[model samples]
Target: MLKGQPRATSPRPAISPAPGASEVFQLLRDGQPRTRAELAQLTGLARSSVASRVDTLMGLGLVAPYGGAASTGGRPPSLFALNPGARAVVAADIGATHARAILADLSGRELAEERQALTIGDGPDAVLGWLAGTVGTLLARGGLPASELAAIGIGLPGPVEHRTGRPINPPIMPGWDRFDVPARVQESYDVPVLVDNDVNIMALGERSFHWPGTTELMFVKVATGIGAGIISGGSLQRGAQGTAGDLGHVRVAYGGEVVCRCGNTGCLEALAGGPALVAALNERTGGTLTSSQDVIELVRSGDAGAVQVIRQAGRDIGDVLAACVNLINPSVIVIGGSLAQAGEHLLAGIREVVYQRSLPLATEHLRIVPSVAGDRAGVTGAAVLAIDHVLSPESIEAACAALTTG
Candidate 1:
């Protein structure tokens, strides 16, 4: 959860800095309702101040009364909770070969969802058009009007300039180089549009959904392309280039002969991504596998050749992650994406190398596990991004002010 604002100083308690609407909203965001006295005690604000903030949030439909709480004495104070039905958020996870769209309430509950076989190479116009249409379909499914939509979040399978929501020199996305994804999507639905790397959002989703308590975490996606979403000190780190987690393109000491899609040699992706794993299995199993799904099924069926290939790929990935462990030392490392569906084979290989090579201290308490969200991690994370955007302190304050004036 995001932190609240600083308190104002005054001589009288009545004039003490009241909690801002955003601050109060954050407290209620957990779906727990509290009386104004409880809020004042927690925030050290005056009862009057808390009431003002509550009234502001209620004005915008962001908070509502949740009936009464058991009173210690006198009349019971009214309990207020987050009003999740105020508006819906649209989330899209666009991959190399497919896309997923979902509508979620402000509280991050999925209202409706749809998946489709959309190609990235289809360019921004075609892809954005389809996504917009999908958003409309979801709105209809949820019985929501366009006006009920508050924000749109997208997770693209490439590096994204988060400030502008544009893809930056993505290797596989042919026509999306520096394309303004948010602006394009905003054309259809004029709302706050957020965009980020698919793995970054996956990391956000994994953390928010499964490990909200863990502060240091890493989400590694091992599909056609490979990347990592880093959460350091409870915040997602994109670094200076928004490619902070491009683990796939990291050079491998032993794979100098391998060519990567980024026109580089010896990248981890070139050696261990899903496509690379499938290709390796074909060499051993006489070309029986084609897609990442094929690789997963083969591994599940206990095919020795496929298992060996995936384990090797995991080892290669672990080689990169070992370095990450030593450098960042995240407590939780979640392996996600289609390849992760192969289960323990990949995790075993990664754990084997990560534990063996990483520093003892770094490896001691580290837990590398498969993703909980599975195939839906991307979409889940996308929704989280939008939810965070709308619920952010600054955004909440601004939106409430707008509503108050309107």
Candidate 2:
């Protein structure tokens, strides 16, 4: 489990900095209830101060009483926790061929979600309009009004200028270049919008929620395209151009005469991505496979040609990741995306090559595993982005002050 914030001083017998409503809310965010005395003791604030902050938070609808704790002696004190239904967050994960939307509360508990087919080639206007309509429907389904949403987050399939939520020269998305995505979305909902690469959000979701203990991690997605999400020291690495871990376009030393979608030749994606694997299998088996899903089904049903190419793709991917492991030395490497569903054939090939080529120390503690959340990782990570943005110290302070006045 994620650890709590370090105490300003020790929890036992020490005078510390005064705790504010944010501090009190953080304490309650652990999903456990604490009485005024317990909170005061933990935060090193006076019982009176604790009460004042708690009352303010209660009025903001972020915290609520959950019944009384066990009484040691005197009267049993009322316990308080975060109200799971106070506000909702809207998160969307837009991929090349599909999109997922989720409605979650302040605590990251998902309320409702919808997944549907969406083509990125349809342009941002059509996609954003569809997203707005879907969000309205989902909010209605969850019995939430539009005013209850605190923020919106989106993960796109291409490189994004994170500050403005705009796609910057995305290769796959034809009409999204330099598009003001956040501005367009805010026109519909009038809320803070966050945008990032789809793989970056997947890495965030994996690290923030699933592997909290992993400070150094990498999430590699090998679907229609190949890319990586790097988390160093528990934060996403977007690099100078917000395209840090773009493993897809990495040029292969041995690849020759293969053209990539980016108009580059001999790129890694052309050599080992899902489309490449499918093309190789189709040529080998003389069968028509339209999508990566077909390749996955073939691998699942024990097709020799599909299995061989997937393993080769894994090794091809591992060759690139071996260099990454030596450079970053991530403690964990989570394999996700469409091809990951092929199971151990792909993982085994990656592990075989990565451990063999990477430094002994790097490979010793490195865990190469498949993604646990699977398809949900993108949406879950988007929710994390929104929740963190809303609960940030600056935002929290402003919100608390506004609540006190309102």
Residue 38 lDDT, candidate 1, scale 0-100: 92
Q: What is the TM-score of each candidate against the true structure?
A: 0.93, 0.90
After superposition, candidate 1 runs with Cα above 4 Å error: 1-19
**Per-structure clash totals for the candidates:** 0, 0
The predictions' CA RMSDs to the true structure, in order, are: 5.3, 5.4
Candidate topping lDDT: 1
**Candidate 1 lDDT over residue span 1-406, tens digit each:** 2122112212222222223678878898887777899999988988888898887777676777776789889998887888788789999999888999999998788999999998899898999999999999999999999999999999998889999999998877889998888888888899999999899999999999899999999999988888899999999999998879889889988997799877889999999987788788788757866799998998899988888889989999999999999999999999998888999999999999999999999988999999998988889999999999989999987876675456
Cα lDDT tens digits, model 2, 1-406, are: 1122111211222122233678877787766777899899998999899988887767666667776679889988887877767778999999988999999987788889899898999999999998888889889989999999999989999999898889999888999999999888888898899999999999989887789789999999998889999999878899988989999999887779799988899899998888888788889878898888899999999988888888988888898999999999999999999899999999999998999999999998899999998988999999999988987767767777675455
Once fitted onto the true fold, the runs of candidate 2 whose alpha carbons sit more than 4 angstroms away are 1-19
In model 1, what is the error at residue 139, expressed in angstroms?
1.4
